[model samples]
Target: MKIPSEMSERIKELAEAISEAERVRVITHIDADGLSSAGIICSILHKEEKQFSVKAIKQLDKDNISELFSNMRSDLLILTDLGSGQADKLPKNKGVCIIDHHQPVSSEILQLNPHFFGIDGSREVSSSGLCYLVAREMGYRDLSPLAIVGAVGDNQDSRGELLGLNKEILKEAEKEGLVIVEKDIRIFGRQTRPLFKALEYTTNPYLPGISGSERGAIEFLEEIGVPLKRGDKWVRLVDLTEEEKKKVLTGLVMRIVKTGGSVESAKVLVGEVYTFPAEKGMLRDAKEYSTLLNACGRRGFPGVGIAVAMGDRNENLRKAESILDEYRREVSEAIELLQKEGLKEKGILKYFLAGDRIRDTVIGTVTSMLMGRREEVLVGMANSENGKVKVSARTTRELTNKGVNLGIALRRAAESVGGDGGGHSVAAGAKIPRGREMDLIEFLEKEIERQVNEIDG
Candidate 1:
């Protein structure tokens, strides 16, 4: 892979920083991207024989930042998948290195972000990819698979293609025989679970009348003559004959269109699918690998995600799989409730207030899932561990193109209420005090209105 001149210069600077640091403290987000970032950095440090410790957090607060800097135990303070936008909050006295791709809040700190070079952080590349660049420069090309997992985890390949630096990382991964890119059905569970269950749980294209309903999916499969089982063994998607798959896919598309779904949505049924032939368990599929890591992150066991990312396949893998099941159940139930209750209309946004019912860590995932279904923007609110509220905001691609930036809006809003927030323009989140939930909504509503009105006016 030919490194662009600008990127090569930046990588050299980052390498210099890494070379200077002896003992390091890595603080990362408790999501798949963050987990992948931590794993990659840890591997690099371990190989280089450097001392380091890691902490995966959901959000950075005063207490968290204080703990990070106040401890004189480590010299280098590294924030991965975070601190790009919260630059002002990061302690200047400490040697801070931010490896992130979010829309950055201006600062003078040493940071490696794609957004600075006119790259789309949300879709083009993820924090894991940026981390991979530094690793590649350091001569650790074997971690490309973990970078792929991180990109998939952040939905950087959500539109059926990996863009910009993500595509480059995939190419390197292919060269290393770490990943195989193929054109196939984009649905989940193609290799692991049974076909009916796969169809039932898929929420990406979101097949109507089948998804989220076990009996509906089963009945539809039977009605279409797609056999669920052969004798005693259940049939998975990988096990299906070409003819059987054709019949099932045709029936599903027809049903979805009959339910008034768009033809464009149906057209997106098949796209580039990523596979890992040598990987065991759910990690074989990039999307499932992401879900497994997410299960650990959102369930307050980011150590498990890092452990799995670092190739621990013993009890840690077993526990991560169990956590994935629990995470799925919670998300399924929460989405169902949101669908039934519907979102509250406010200005150009549609918001759902989950309050204390949903977990704070999973609110962003839920909000993103709710996007593009009768809403210009989706806001998910949950009660935080402290007396604060967690806020997750998501905007449609249509709205994003229409000049909406939730990152700036949420960051400004959260800061106004003595909180902090910022991320990609499309998907961003914040943590605000308990009584400031309504303030956040009002501020966000006004900010979104300001953007839309600026374009319209």
Candidate 2:
């Protein structure tokens, strides 16, 4: 675990600031990575007998930021998972440490971000991974598992692999005997539910015909000769024999191709999956844990998400479970809406405008779930309560190889119309004025076309 010289200096600065502070407050985004980063820091502070409070917000708005700055009662403020993008909007407060992986903004406050070290924040690392590295450098080694879970939460492991600094965190977890990584089917409900039902709910790299239809999933399994039961008991994905597993994957690939789905999507059918040997229950598996956290965040129960991430298993976990159920229900319904309305094609992109029918937070998830290779860019828009239109853009992983950075494109496009935006290369989002929808789209199309040509040229 040799630390890079530049990152080593920043980590040391943050550790020292924590040592000198009497009272600290942790602020993080509401996503799984944010919750995990808060949980990890909370644990570290608790162990060291430091005074701290953790808060998770959906986004940092002007009013909320002002209130936090005005009500500053703590000696130190640590912003995680966010605050890196809109650095200009942040308050000029001393003793502030922002640990984030998103694109950076210029400010005088202490900042430790992956981009600062020439690292790819979107795929190679997450805010939690960065925080975990800081904690590990401070000699808190047991928190490695939570950091790994946080990386998975952020979709850094979407390609069925962890890269760069994330790989280092995985190695630390392995040495501590906390995790076991295997090359297996990377479905959501593999260990927790029946095989058919698992396939029915699969969304990422979403299986076309079999995804939302239980009957279709069941038929696929049966056609593939995978035994649904043995000795009168239904078998889950974890129960399948290696031979049966291979057959199942082969069948899924063929099904993807037969349904006119992308062969690249079919190639994403099987990959590395991580399992926790010590933790129990559904969240014990990394992917399931991430999904539950996502459900909580999208449904406005981020506090409960943090509680569960920090090991609160009483009413909070039950409440989170209920939230997850409801979240899935909403997502399924929203997906149905999009499927029925369908996407409107305009030149190189396709889109669905849900207006006020869908929440802004859920639009991104829905866009990613329904994205296909046929459309170079997929956009989903919903009206938020704040008057601005929230837009989510998604592109296929394979398409990103063609030199498209949706995050970068979306940011520039949104800014041209007096809005704000940014995200990863594959998935990005923006907030824009209500009347500028078409203008933004046209700009995005042109930018994407030019970027691709420049890369290919």
Candidate 3:
């Protein structure tokens, strides 16, 4: 796994810029990848004895961008995991560097996005990976695990494995003995939860009747001839035999097909599972580590996530673990709400209006989980502060290949309604003024249909 020379040179230049700055101000998103990116850069800067300040935000909008320039306290500004798509809105003489993996708009600001080098920013690399490359150029290769965590958090490993620059970072982590990768059942909570609980919580492959039902998961396991317990000890996915694992996987595929899901969706169930040997409990697995970070951020404790990623395990890790429990409960409650109150359909899209019932931060995650159960694009909306609505949309990889870019569509729709939005093709988000949800949905439907029709022609 060799680094592209051009990208490597760009990373060196960014490292030089960071070294030359007297003081740095970092603004990162309030998500796992964003927090992971902040942890890497902040740790490196601290080691280098550089003065820096950091802030974690939910999104980059006009008000925050204005505040960033008005209250300037540092010689340089670094926006990680975000800001590439909003580059044009940033000031020109502010000494800004956008270290992100999202698609970039034309701007004069310095950016280290993989999209500029013909790399698939959505799938190949993430903001954390880009930041890790900068850290590597600065002689800090041991931070590879954080990069892997960020990539997994961003769902760049949707193919059940890391690819492109992410794979390159994984190789570095392997060399440092920080991460070990293997093929296994790709579900949440393999390291922390019981076997049936893990099966009940699976979402990517999204077991139809078993996913949200504890009894269903138990019955499915029993039907597959895999005992729920071995002589009084409950079975974990980690404790399954090779033959038993195959049986469970086969059962999963059959369940998906029986529920009208494509066989290709079930293929994601058995792929690379990343283990962080140096970490304990849930932190040992890359996906679970990312989930912990997400829990911290969504629970309004982004600092705790950053601290855990920066090697803090005393109070911060305990707080993060506590937050994870609460986050899971909130997520389950939100999902139950969706199940009780079905989504509204418009053309090829299905949407739900949470209207303050669901937290805006959790809407994107909730929408992603529900996407596996439907053929139409899933859109979720929740009330935000300042009388705004936050919208998160998700679609299948199959539809993305059919030229349905939710990022572009949502951006256009948001701007039409005087809002802002941008993200990957499969997942995107927006925040629009209140009383405009209907307008946004209508425009989004047209945009998605147009994209598909153009491709069909």
Candidate 4:
């Protein structure tokens, strides 16, 4: 594909770096979006027959950074989805190219994010869209399918619109028959799976019965006699009997409009199951890869996730499944811990600590799950693999309506403690140095208090 004339210079620079480098290393975040971004780059490298390795990391800590720098055989390192912050920790090597959409920590890093051009990086555009920019620069338009997958994985299309280059790429993908664009309502409330299996997978709209057990969810579905699956295997809600459908539909009335701009209504249907055909043995049939990849990262073995995204098969798939099961178990246990310990609601900050094993990957999901229970801002913190404190902050539209920006507050708080953090204004995260967890929490509390006071005053 021809490079967009506007980004031609930057694209040329990236291509030159790739052509000149002896070895290349790609690092990305450990979520579905991150994996999809990594997959796009990896696919390009594979087609070009370039020597490279991919690493999926939860957070760029001192140990991981040190290991990456020490083992650096590549003349160039490309970081995607992450690395907007940590400019200080960025490898000093001359051959570094970063493609991301997050708000950067400093002007120098900010200049690298495509959003600086007034492009919407939040959901309208994603890290994958940014990577698509890089690919367009490299003259590989054929890889746009990978870019679309990354965008979708990142929830970029949840609102029924695509922004910036993503729209252009979607048009291209549609022309190539790689993607089918349709106007449809995606149901985010209640799973049609069995109670035990729903608890195991923790699919949205359906919290497990053990932790935030939605008794209403189980009763409504059971009274309707809808057969729920054991695991996350998709079941058609439309397949249920007419009476069961009415009961299940009647019970799923709690509308969960996320504050970060996903404000769609949910509808209960009896025979409206939508499926995507599998792409090259990957579970493209399932639209939940984003959640699955996140579970993999939270449970450990982020590399297994990278392998799956990179299209590894056989043993790699088995390992990924095993790791995901362990992740479910850990999440169940963590929810139990959160319930016993309970969460504290202080002004705009609602939080609970789930010991050292919970980590940041699960925080976002858990926080979103708890949103139905409370209308306050949500913040969940856990310890990282390096013993440092990891924090994920989320807010509802109610809070955003008051002009509260959790991302800015969390970034400032994390930086005040000499840590790295930044994300969208509605949702964000940070990793503080070990032993500074309380300091970070206190800082966030004060910031939230200040924001509320300023608005009220």
Candidate 5:
């Protein structure tokens, strides 16, 4: 839980820089973690009455970087959730700051990242957690809940519970009475949706027939002797008794195994659920809150997500609910389309080209949801604006443990094809020319094979 002395000192320096800046311009990724990071920094800046502006971007690529800062006026620029991998592209004329957890390229800019201190950024902490450490150094620790939400959003809790610095942040949230951590069913929408709907909507584990099947979920519950409702009201997961919960968990594992899924899929079924009592509906639960943030950000409403994270529960929350419905529908439809069309397998990867059928902004989310369905690394691609292709790649912890670095591979592969990419060992992304999808895939296939063989060699 103790912050490394060097990391702590770095955070302190960043805090000081923020305090001294006359006007700050913040550019963050347009995802849950990025939005949460933006929310945390912006909330503190708002409290201090500092002049600041924010832009949520899909990716910190060349055109994006040039457009976002060509006419920069702020005294300081802070890039959150992103900018570590593209540090060289950042403007050098201004005081640039990077608070991110992605794998970093060498840079001289003022930055704070966990990887620099021998920590696993992918699983240990998230960009939001790093932002919270800065907030803590700035004497604002109440933002811990947002940090936890970001961690969850990044799937840092893949083991069903947070680890490393995230666990430390959870402690801060708990101590401040802002969060309640409990071990419970780790399905989506546990706080708001009915039990059948929650089971039907879960795609992380891609639960056999239950996922994407309302009738299947209901039948599974009924077959397990769990009642569908309590006195005519459909029960939520929270409404179940301890005995019924155990039965459901057991049934879920059995169902997954029976349908050819690894028991490992069930690892994510039950874990620590962080609840914020002060917040209502989906915002009260860390997973659901993070999902809501993702819904807003991915659907081109990053401001709504940021506002909700900054404690706006009226207009922004209302807008976010609609976005959530749309986002979920799109995700379900995308998954069904992918499943129906099938994935293409190469030497060491399974991939699909959405060809703009899926939005570029949500391709990564789709790729993640499609992870547990296969053993090979999954690569998802979608056509982007301006004749570009967006690529999102994901691998399991097992493959990562076997020395499969998607970040390094994708970075090298993208660079070879006149693009840029890098992230964590397990998950990464890139952007390339429109017709270069196959080139990217070919490069990844060879690189992954070499990586796997090198570890064995």
Candidate 6:
């Protein structure tokens, strides 16, 4: 892959920094994209024999930033997936290099994100794509597959095509013969992986209907009694077979026209079921890595996820998988509890789970899943390790059409209550001083109502 001329200078500078620095620290978001970005960097550093440590953060707060700079004591810091929004809080030292694709919030960090340079930063291109660009800039073309996997894990491949640097990376992967893109014929129903395993691994299993759960994925082969082994589990899609694959022109289609569809509806509406074959085996598949990584981020062990992505085998992968499954079960149980309690629907769908079991990591997935079920935006709040109330918000593009920017609203609301928050238009998050959770929620409700009324009026 040829490096873009525009980014050549920046990439050269970054490579020099990596080469010259004795100790380096890499921090990234904890989601699949972030983990993948970190993995790519890690792989490069590993190949170059550069000493480095990686940290996966859920949200970049003041304390974490301070601690990172204070504890790492490194000559260089490379931040990925995150740090675009918290540019102001970034270390003042000149040794930091940020590679990201999220929408830039301020002019100070605008130069750091490639999207500001006319690159697409939506699902079409992700942080991994940005990381790939950085790697290409550094002259490591072999690591492009890491970027592709990260993009896929981030759901950037959902459109069935790649755009921007994502496409460039895919082409590179194809040239390397690392990825094979063939037209898929079989119609796998909603679930694709082991339902129990996916639930255990997902941040919000309840929204699998909308977000697409591999566990319940239906497939033509499974429908015909062909047993498929995916990972360590057995899966069969009851509605698909080789004959059905020949008959069906496309994969199964699920639609969620409105919010609050059945879990089944959610599954069908959001994702396409297909079969994926790798050297390990051929099996039914779905996109669940986003939710899985979100769960890991919310739980404060994003490094484990990065390790898993790096192809960690044996005990480490199993341990990470166990932790993920346990977290998923807890979140599922919490959602069930919320439904059973029948909490009144405010302007936003919300549920509060008390006790230390609830982590800041799961809030984004839980809230996003809840919002996916309703027309209005959804917000989920939980207690964090620092005794602060962590809040997560998710809004659809439809809501954004009404001029609803949950990121701005939530950030202002959180700040008003003596907390800090910010995020994208569709999804955002914040951390508030403990005991101000309700106040923050009330403020968000008022702001959302005002925005809706203004648009309607």
lDDT of all predictions: 0.83, 0.83, 0.88, 0.63, 0.89, 0.62
- Candidate 6: residue 354 Cα off by (Å): 5.5
Candidate 2 Cα errors over 4 Å, as ranges: 61-64, 396-402, 453-457
- Backbone clashes under 3 angstroms, per model: 0, 0, 0, 4, 0, 26
Q: Across residues 1-457, which tens digit of lDDT does each residue of candidate 4 receive?
A: 3334545566566767776776789988877778778877777787678999988877664556777777667877888888775655676667677777776654333224655555657666778666766666677766565666667656555445555677877777667665655433233222343442443354443333422344644564565566565356544532445575455445443323332212222321121222334353224423445555665666666677667766676777778767766666666666666656878866556777755657567877666555533346777887765567778887654676676767678888998897877777667888888777778888988987787778888
After TM-score superposition, the amount by which residue 338's alpha carbon in candidate 6 deviates from its true location, in angstroms, is: 2.6
Kindly report which residue stretches of model 4 are placed more than 4 angstroms away from their true locations once superposed: 1-9, 61-67, 88-92, 107-112, 136-142, 157-167, 182-202, 206-219, 225-235, 238-249, 254-282, 357-360, 373-375, 449-457
- Reference-based TM-score, model 6: 0.77
Query: Against the true structure, what is every candidate's RMSD?
Result: 2.1, 2.1, 2.0, 5.1, 1.5, 5.4
Candidate 5 per-residue lDDT, tens place, 411-451, comes to 99998898888999999999998898899999999998899
Ranking of all candidate structures by their lDDT, best first: 5, 3, 1, 2, 4, 6
- What TM-score against the true fold does each predicted structure earn? 0.94, 0.94, 0.94, 0.79, 0.97, 0.77
* Model 1 worst lDDT run, 10 consecutive residues: 260-269
Model 3: number of backbone collisions: 0
Best by TM-score: 5
Off by over 4 Å in 6: 1-12, 107-111, 157-164, 182-235, 242-259, 262-300, 342-344, 348-357, 449-457
Name the lDDT of candidate 1: 0.83
What's the lDDT for candidate 6? 0.62
Kindly report which residue pairs in candidate 5 clash with one another: none
Q: Roughly what TM-score does model 3 have, to 2 decimal places?
A: 0.94
Task: Give the per-residue lDDT digits (tens) of candidate 2, residues 121-216.
Answer: 988888888888778878988878788888988778867688888888898798888888888888878988889988887777667667777898
The ten-residue window of minimal lDDT in model 6 covers: 275-284
Report the lDDT of model 6 for residue 18. 76
lDDT of 6 by residue, 1-457 (tens): 4445665566576667777887888989887788878878887787778789998877777767787778557877888887776677676667777777665665343235765566546555678777776677677776665676667555555445556677777777677766655544212222454333332333322433322334443343244334456567564333345564433222222222332444332332233332223322211232443444445565677877777556565554666656756666666666655555644456664545444545567656555544444356767777886778878777666677887877778878988998878766677788888888778878988888788788999
Which stretches of model 1 miss by more than 4 angstroms?
205-213, 250-269, 373-375
lDDT of 3 by residue, 55-155 (tens): 89988977568977776878888999999889999899647899988877879998999988989888999999999999998999989999999999998
Error of 1 at 270 (Å): 2.6
Candidate scoring better on lDDT of 1 and 6: 1
